[model samples]
Target: MNDIAAIPVWAIIPVSLLLIVGGSIVLIGALGLLRLPSFYQRIHGPAITVTLGAGCLLIASMIYFTVLQSRPVIHEIIISLFLLLTAPIVAMMIMRAAVYRDLRAGKKDAGAAAGGIYQFPEESE
Candidate 1:
C-alpha cells in the first residue's frame, strides 16, 4: 500500500531485520519445545526465548508504528512490560505444579531435581 511504500529505507531495514530475527527466535523456541527430551527442559526453551523473541517483535512494532504515524507509539511497551512480569511467574508456577504432581505421584527424583526445596508431606505409620 501507499503507507508502506512511504516508509523510508532506514526504518524499513530495521523493521525487516527485527521481524526476521524475532520470527527466527520464536521458531527456535518452538523447535526447542518439540526437540527437548523432558518437561523441565522443554519449559526452559519457550520460557526464555518467548520473552526475548516477543520483546524483539514488540520493539519492531513500536518502531514501525512510530515511524508510520510520525509519533511515539508506545502501546507495545505496556504489552512488553506485562509479558516480562508474567511470563516467568507463569513458567515458575507451571514448574511448581509439575513438581508437586510428581511428588504426589511418589517421584522422589522430582524433589531431588528441585534441589530438595519442596516440602514432602510426612507419612504416618
Candidate 2:
C-alpha cells in the first residue's frame, strides 16, 4: 500500500525485528516441545514461550498496521487479551490432567530429573 511505502525505515526496522524475534521465539518453543523429556516440561513450551512469541508478533502487527494505515489498529489487543487469559488456564489444565494420569498410574514423584523423568543406570554385566 502507498501508506506502508511511505512509512519510515525506522518503523520498518522495528517491525521486522519484532517479527523475526517473535518467529524465533515460536520456533524455540516448538523445539522445546520436541526436545523436552516429559509432558510437564513440554507443556511450558506453548504456555510460556509460544505465548510470548505470539505477543511479540501481535505487537509487531499492531505497530505495522497502525503506522501503515495512519490509524490505531487495536483489534490485536482483543486477541492478546484472549491469549493471556487462556494460555495459563490451558497450561494448568494440561498439568492437572497429566498429574492426575501419573497419579492414577502410580508414577507420582517417581523421579527427580525434570518432570519426574528417570534416567536409569544400567547394571554391569
Candidate 3:
C-alpha cells in the first residue's frame, strides 16, 4: 500500500529491527522447545516464547500502530496481563500432572519426597 511505503526511513528501520528481534526470540524459543529434554524443560521452552517473544511482538505492533496513526494505542497490555497470569497456571498444572504420573510409576527416587507430591500407602502383597 502507498501508506506503508510512505513511512519515514528512520521509522522503517526501527520497525524492521523490532520485527527481526521478535522473530529471533520466537526462533530461539522454538529451538529450546525441541532441544530441551524432559517434560519440565519442554514446558519452560514454550514459556519463553509465550513471555518474551509475545512481549516483543506486541511491542513491535504497538510501535508500528502508534507511528502509523500518531495515536496512543495500548490494548496489548490486556493480552500481556492475561498471558502472565495464565501461562504460569497452565505450566504449573502440566508440571504437577507430570510429577503425579512419574510418582505413580515409581520413577522418582524414595529420597525425593517433598511436600505437595502424591503419596500412596504400601500394599501388603
Candidate 4:
C-alpha cells in the first residue's frame, strides 16, 4: 500500500530489524522446545520464549506501531501487562501438574528428576 511505502527508510529499517530479531527469538524457543529430550529440558523452552521472546516481540510491536502512528502508542503495554501477569502463573501450574502426575504415579525419583542441580534423596516410607 502507498501508506506502507511512505514510511521513512530509517523507521522501516529499525522496525524490520526488530521484527526479524523477535521472530528469530520465537523460532529458537520453539526449536528448543521440540529438540529437547526430557520434559524438564522442554519446560525451559516455553519459559524462555514467554519471558524473553515474547518481550522482544512485544517491544517490536510497540516500536512498529509507534513509528507508524508518529507517536508513542502504548496499547502494547496492556498486552504486555496481561502476559506478564499470566505467563509465570501458567508455567507454575503446568510444572505443578507435571510434578503431581509424577507423585501420583509413585515415582520415587520424581524429586531427583525435577532437581537439576542439587541432589534430592528419595524419601523412605
The TM-score leader among the candidates is 1
Error of 4 at 71 (Å): 3.7
**Number of the predicted model whose lDDT against the real structure is largest:** 1
Each prediction's whole-model lDDT (CA): 0.91, 0.82, 0.75, 0.75
| Model 1, span 1-125: residue lDDT tens | 99999899999999999999999999999999999988978998999999999999999999999999999999999999999999999999999999889888887677555577776877999
lDDT of 3 by residue, 1-125 (tens): 98797677877787788788878888887888889866667777787577777777777787777778888878978887888788878877877777777777877442233454465666689
Each candidate structure's TM-score, on Cα atoms with residue i matched to residue i, is 0.91, 0.81, 0.78, 0.81
**Tens-digit lDDT track of model 4 for 3-108:** 6876778777777777788788889889999999877678778876776667767877787778778899888888888888888788778877777676668765
Instruction: Name the 10 consecutive residues with the lowest summed lDDT in model 1.
Output: 107-116
Of 1 and 3, the candidate ahead on lDDT is: 1
TM-score of predicted structure 1: 0.91
